[model samples]
Target chain A: MTEPTAVIHDIGYRHYDGVRLGRGRATLALGVQSLRGVFGFGRTTRAKIMPLLLMAIMLMPTVVSIGVMALAKQFIMPYPGYAVFMQAVIAVFLAAQSPYLVAPDLRFRVLPLYLSRPLTVTDYVVAKLAALAVALFGLLAVPITIQFVGELLVDLPGPPHTADYLGALGGAVLYAVLLSSVGIALASFTPRRGLGVAVVIAFYMFTAAVSTLFYAVLSSTGRDDVAPWALILNPFFLVDTVQSALFGTAPINDEGYPPGIAACLILLAVIALAVTGVLLRYRKAAS
Target chain B: MTASATPCFATEGLTKRFPRVTALDDLTVAAGTGVTGLVGANGAGKSTLIKILLGLLPPTSGRASVLGLDTATQGLEIRRAVGYMPEHDCLPPDISATEFVVHMAQMSGLPRTAARERAADTLRHVGLDEERYRPMGGYSTGMRQRVKLAQALVHDPRLVFLDEPTNGLDPQGRDDMLALIRRVGTEFGIDVLVTSHLLGELERVCDHVIVIDGGRLLRSSAIREFTRAEQTIAVEVEEGQRRLAERLAALGETVAAQGRLLTVQVSADDPGRTHDAVRDAVCDLGLSLLRLEQRRGRIEDVFKEPVA
Candidate 1:
């Protein structure tokens, strides 16, 4: 038998031959990617519509508040109380948009792809939570910044205005952390975005309704003293309670706000629970 | 192999038991470099073993190591070094392949600029052209598999675990994917642990083959050794094939005539004598020796061998 001739062909396959940045850099990159994912960047146009619309809805109230303040020479929306004024809109935004951060990854079984990378489960959880927190922070900061700039432009009393602006900035950061943790924590459980959105909204709406009902009953029964206990159950009321205590914003509800220490403790507990939930959820094989 | 040269992976009495059933049972094996085909039927613990090696699942007892890194403790390091293409369809539908692969490259610790450039190169290498820009939701099964392969290789891993990559592909698609997998091993020099339930598909590309049955290793050896010549020789004669077979049988040789050819069992005491006897019988009978060939063992023959 004749021997067969051998030939070689170039496939243009090259090795990376680059420095690997390791797990820390990997976690940071995942965080940045998830952050962009939250805003629907690099996703389909249909994916972008929801985040963009919710963002616009989130900004409209601030734009209107800023416009009113500029024209009327009065603070239409208090800086610290802005999240409270648009609590439902902000809640809706968190409920609808936060799932975009995690649910799709879970639904698509892409966790294997990630866990197979240089990242650990804890790193994944941190990256996702950080991304959502940053997105939520950016989401809320825009409105707060608009209001702060409006206050500065209109020359609303310098000392108090600057102090309130700083306080509002701090309050926005707190709100972003708490709300984003809760939203993404819930979203991570389900693979379906619709289910994620529904579960989140149901959670927010149910707790708010229950808190309102319980507080109304207590006030009607002449036990107004205990009404503050009911407001602590709802995240919206919890945020309002904390914001009022933190920035010294006037209470928006008829039931008196919980004391700063009590509100802070409860908010911390909620944040802890949500963050723990995120960690525990990822502790299992996500795929 | 030298003592300094570690196998791609080695397992020692590895066992994994779920709540209801045991998936892997005391599997002890070592896979050397080059393409190693992991052949097992469905539900034979192939995926379970892969998960344990990936450090995604903890084995119930014993230990495993990938690239000399202990799977129990150095899971992240193992993952960092190895790439995996899952058996299922796991691509996100809303995102384009370019964006998704870039994100994965970045997630693998590449900087943004490096990730994008690597993703582009990797996609091109996987045969995804401008169509990489389109969302994966509309991609064909073949395209989706290419996308999956692109993501796995984009990070330039030292080894890759391809679990049933040709699962949903057509015949032509399977051939193309197998060719690509062969290129990955031969051209790129990346060690591969590819799995398939089909017995013969991997015979062409793999240097070694590992066969697992019911979660236990049935055999692990070089493909060439596994398919080594059996103690049998196929003989043909130009004319009087039956007469030649009769003459060979009369010479105290076990012979079975199969139409134009005869299968002679080589004497266990002296295998070379069987070939000599056949030539002598053919020469004496005035019959021309048409063809003489030794039969090689096939993968299917392993199943027929009695379990030890």
Candidate 2:
């Protein structure tokens, strides 16, 4: 038998000599990728339908409100009331897309790939939460900004109106954080994306319906002072209460939204709980 | 960095206990640079040890370290330095290989441009070409395995832990995967800790062999040491093999003769003298020497023998 000769195949596996940005940059990369995922950036065309359709629905009111003001020479919808009017649309958007950001990773068992990187479990959870918050903020802010800009072009509502619009923008940031936190936290537990959507929507519907009924019952019985407390149960109501306090606008519900301090504390408590749940669910490196 | 003075990984009294079963029991093993084979049966704690080394799971007791960093305290640092390819499928179906690998490279701290470039290079290295742009849901098992391996190597980690890389491949596919793994260790100068349950699969590539049974270390040594030739020789003659065996036995060499072959046991202390005696005995008996060679021990022999 002839002796076998050694053969080398040069596949050109080059060593990476570039700088590694380490854990912070890894977390930032994760956050950016997840944010892109929420809108179906690398997904199929069909995957883009829900998020785009929801976004259009959320922005539709602002466009129609601006058109009404242009035709009738008056503000059709108050800037601070945007959250109150667009609550359901925005909630649907969050419910539909928040699961897109997290559930796939869990169901597909891709967390091991992420956890085995330079990233920690805290970085993983924080990056995902921060991504949802940023996406939700953009979703709520862009239309408000467009409306604010449109309002400026058409007519001058004066300095007070400008201040209110600015305040409403700030409150939009809070709304984004609170709403997205709750949506993502609820979606994190359910591994199936479809089931996650149901859980999120049900969470919103159940709390809003129960709280509204309780408020109506309490007000009819003449316990008006305690009726606002029922609004605390609904996340949308929490957004409205905080928006009213921040922009000095009238509350959306009949029972003037919860007292300012109590409302802010309740929103903070909800955000804290949601964030805690998210962190706990992803505490394992590869769950 | 190339394989440094320190070992690739080391564990001391490493034990992991699930609620119902003990996954690993007092596994104390260390491997230096080069391709080391971690051979074990299914459920033999190979995956468990890899997870602990990657800092994806904390050991229930004892201590372990990878690349000179503690698994518990410096997990992030260890992960940054090491890469892991899991035994099971973990690729997401919705994304393309280029997109997925770029995301993973960036998540390993590579800048965007670098991540993209490195991802392309990694894909090519793994033998993926234009098809990389297609979603991985359509990829075959071999292609999927290659994609998984590409992601593990895209970050240019110093060492890699590959578990069952040949788990679902045909004969040709397994051969190609093994060659790729060997090149990763030799050409790239990266240390590797590869696992397989097929005992003979690792024989051709690994420089060191580590055998584990039920999560405990069975044997640890260089591949040569494990498969070295024993103090025995096989003698084949054209004829009179029984007579020749009797002659060798008369010389006090323990002999067992087959039809035309004599199996002679040589003295461990004076093997060369025994060789001369056998040659002299074969010539005196007028038997033509057809073959004379020492018997090489196999890895299966160690399993048959007790720990000594």
Candidate 3:
């Protein structure tokens, strides 16, 4: 007589009978979405122009170098050197795209819907930062992979060549980590997408100009002993010094850059500060 | 409607103080399963209360729980079982509604394939035709609202918090949205806590109503109790309504004029005679009777009649 199942009525409402996932799957989804957003995937044609144009420009040098290798069995441009020559393009790409990923959510106030799910503020920050970094890595790695393939076809295989290729990939990773954390941390400040874009571009231009001016002034004033330190003010230069020390590559900005260990420490410290700033921004936004 | 014994959400001694003012002041309330209405003005802390219950914001002093889990300590668990549709614009302009809703479904932890299927079903349920494939930037206000509702329902949580869902809709759109809210509760068996600043907008949908003003709870009861039949008949005539009121008053009937309409009280012993008296009065005055009906109480009277 106590069969409760017999008394209950079945309504037409469809319930979710399948599995409900937890935080990990949710974070992964957000990360994958953000990454696709950076490349203008699943967006309008108007949204795809800037990223595609910049990506095309970034690969121009790779195309020319690969063509030269076709006529001769020699590698013209090193993998990391491609990043150095194209630092301006990479900076422009980050400037144009980082705000596209973070500004809309804040402008439209979409974080409330996101925070209402099983996701945390920290999870949000991690997913966004990781997505931007991975996007930047792809931007830098695609050319390198093409070159690696070209070298394999041309029999440019040796221990030094393999080591150099690996080191360049490592440098690309460093650039991605440093650039994305700083770019996203800065872009998350404003709610307007236009303001965010302006902020990121202004940040890059200001640092690059000031660092170059300081480097020239220090060297001309006979303070050559301290001129190499001015390069750290710029992100690309900071990354170059670390790559030079760690991978035994040539430094892009200054010949007498700091030692490998000190450069590595500074790189790690900047990344740590930028990531902490990102987490703090989301914490306030969620509240 | 499930016999869970506990209410859907409960808050005790809940108070939230900001720098300039108190958002929620010592509010203690519990809501049962069904369609419940949270009626308050813009600054009455409805949004603040939802945020605290979602575990996104911590109350200054108090404790709250949703679906029997602590909002402070078990926010993830609470959010896993609760859905929220924010009042503001939250959709990206360039993405299609289907794409955005499916992605949001995955963000709620549904598998990719299942997320797409549920997204399609929920979109159809919200009444978006093939237009669901177009970018949301090109959608009308009603279409956007449907997309917002679809995302909230795609995951199919046990409860949903819809803040001002009918805020910017036309009259017909308002009616359609109310019918949809009712269906969400009755047909789907999902508990709903919908809020509105206007008094009577939600009475047709919500089974229960809660009234709060200036961050204070005024009343909470079943909607039927809030709006029951009264012992008064409302009479609206094409002309000479004032003369009809005077004739009814002269006949020992308690009559009051509210603008062009009159409300006549009936004796508990002989209600049919009062109706006959009104009909006779309208005919003798030679005025066309535009309307004659027993008046039902309204939720607005909850604040008006109780204190008066």
Candidate 4:
């Protein structure tokens, strides 16, 4: 028998001498990847089911309103009112998906992998916040844009007003920032995705119910001044107050705009608080 | 600094104390670029030292650096140049290995195309075949380990701190992983600091071994220095062990007798002479020779005293 010859293959490990792109590009990739993850772009069919369904549901009213505008020769749904109309669906999206984005890293202990990279704790938090904000912006802006375009396509009582459309676009930005801060802040605390979903849903429902209930009790009791302040309890109402004050959209709870720029201040404060919650949660997780 | 000039990592009186207990107590050691094994029993602070060196955790008292970057102030730069494969199961269950590794490569600053190509190359290098496309939820422990390893290498790090990489592998998987670790240091040009509780396993792949216990450095030396063979021969007889020991000891040979085994010292001047004497004495005593071989010192011997 012949002795076997020992041969080594030029395989296994290969060194990469390409462009690294450094921390800026790494943070950008994390943000883009996270934004794609929010709507289940790179995920499975089972994962794609929830986000896409919620989107279709969100667009349902826009389709119906466009059909109404075509047949009745009048635009029924205003661009700014589309999100408030589909607020429940938007809330469900946030509750279901914020956990999908944040919980896996904590549950599986993958933060070490990310923190071990060129990314810092603050970098991770900011990227996730930015992703959620951008995603939420898309959720609101798309339907609002379709409504504007649909109004232009149909015969309306008046031509689609560009000023109001721009106002609603401004409202979408406020809603995006506020909702994302709240969504990530709530989801970061619950590591178990199942529990995170429940926590978010419960948090939104509790705050929303409390705000509406307090508004009803206070305004009906002639305590009108204190009633609009209660609306700040709900996240949608909080942003909607800012939207209503700035863009002159129909206020959902308050009779009129809350004082002057007090609504905007309240929103900025609440956003700051929720963002702090997110930062603290991540700091603890990283440590 | 050039990669070859500075050590892979170094510590200066590094100490990390938790609220209740200290994890790394004044560990001061440095290793060159090679497969250096960080070995200790469980809870011996091997993982803690790696974390401090990776700049993920700040040492309570002292300082550390990897590739000349400080662990505290220059953590981001250090992490950019270093890769870490955590000991635990860190893979997200939903994504395929290819997608996960690609994202990780990008997170480590690799460009998109480079990330993809390196992900494939690294996955194949780690022996993940078509299974790289499969979701990691269904992977066995061995495959998951390979995926973890692939992610660490996907960005082509200059050095990698592999924390208990062979934690849950079978015997064959362990051997394959050790061989891959050796190749990672030499063939890939990436220095490695692999940790294990099993001392015997690292003896095969490590160019140097560092032994720590109770958060303190015990010994650090080249592998050859640790495993240098003693001047002794191990003799085993089928029967008449007492007669053989008596004959050898009477012939002025140092013999330590056990049940059926004997260790006879070989003189430095006449090594073959001692072997002949043992063989002839056993034959005269009519004891059948079962085995005769030189005694080689083991890495495990360092722990024998403390363990007993």
Among all windows of ten consecutive residues in candidate 1 chain A, which has the lowest summed lDDT? A156-165
> After superposition on all CA atoms, how large is the RMSD of candidate 1?
7.0
Chain B TM, every candidate: 0.77, 0.77, 0.86, 0.81
What does candidate 3 score on TM?
A: 0.90
Put down candidate 4 lDDT per residue, B168-211, tens digits, no spaces.
Answer: 89989999999999989888888999999877778789888898
The sequence of per-residue lDDT tens digits that candidate 4 reaches over residues A19-96 is 888787888899999999888899887888998899888888888888998898866776766777788899999999
Question: How does each model score on lDDT?
Answer: 0.84, 0.85, 0.85, 0.85
Q: After superposition, how far is residue B144 of candidate 4 from its true place, in Å?
A: 1.2
Model 1 residue B186 CA deviation (Å) reads 0.9
Best by TM-score: 3
What's the TM-score of chain A alone for every prediction?
0.90, 0.91, 0.92, 0.92
DockQ of each: 0.55, 0.55, 0.69, 0.72
Model 1: per-residue lDDT, tens digit, A51-110?
A: 788889888877887777778767777666677777888888888887877887888999
* lDDT per residue as tens, model 1, B1-308: 22238889999999999999888999999999888999888988999999999988899999999999999899878988899999988899877999999889988888888889999988987889988998899999999999999999998999999999889889899889999999898888889999988656777678888888778988887876554434578898888988888888889999988778899988877888999999899889998888998754344567777643
List RMSD in Å for every model shown: 7.0, 7.3, 5.6, 4.9
Tell how far residue A60 is off in model 4, in angstroms: 1.2
Docking class of 4: medium
**Model 3 Cα lDDT, one tens digit per residue, A158-194:** 5336667777888999999999999998899987778
Model 2 per-residue lDDT tens digits across residues A1-287: 98879886765778999999989988998998888878877678998888888888878988987897688767877777777778788878888988888898888888889988988778888888889888888888888888888887778455426766777777888888898889889999977999999999999899989998998899899998898889778887787788778677667676476688878888899999998988888885264
lDDT of 2 at B33: 94
Best by the DockQ measure: 4
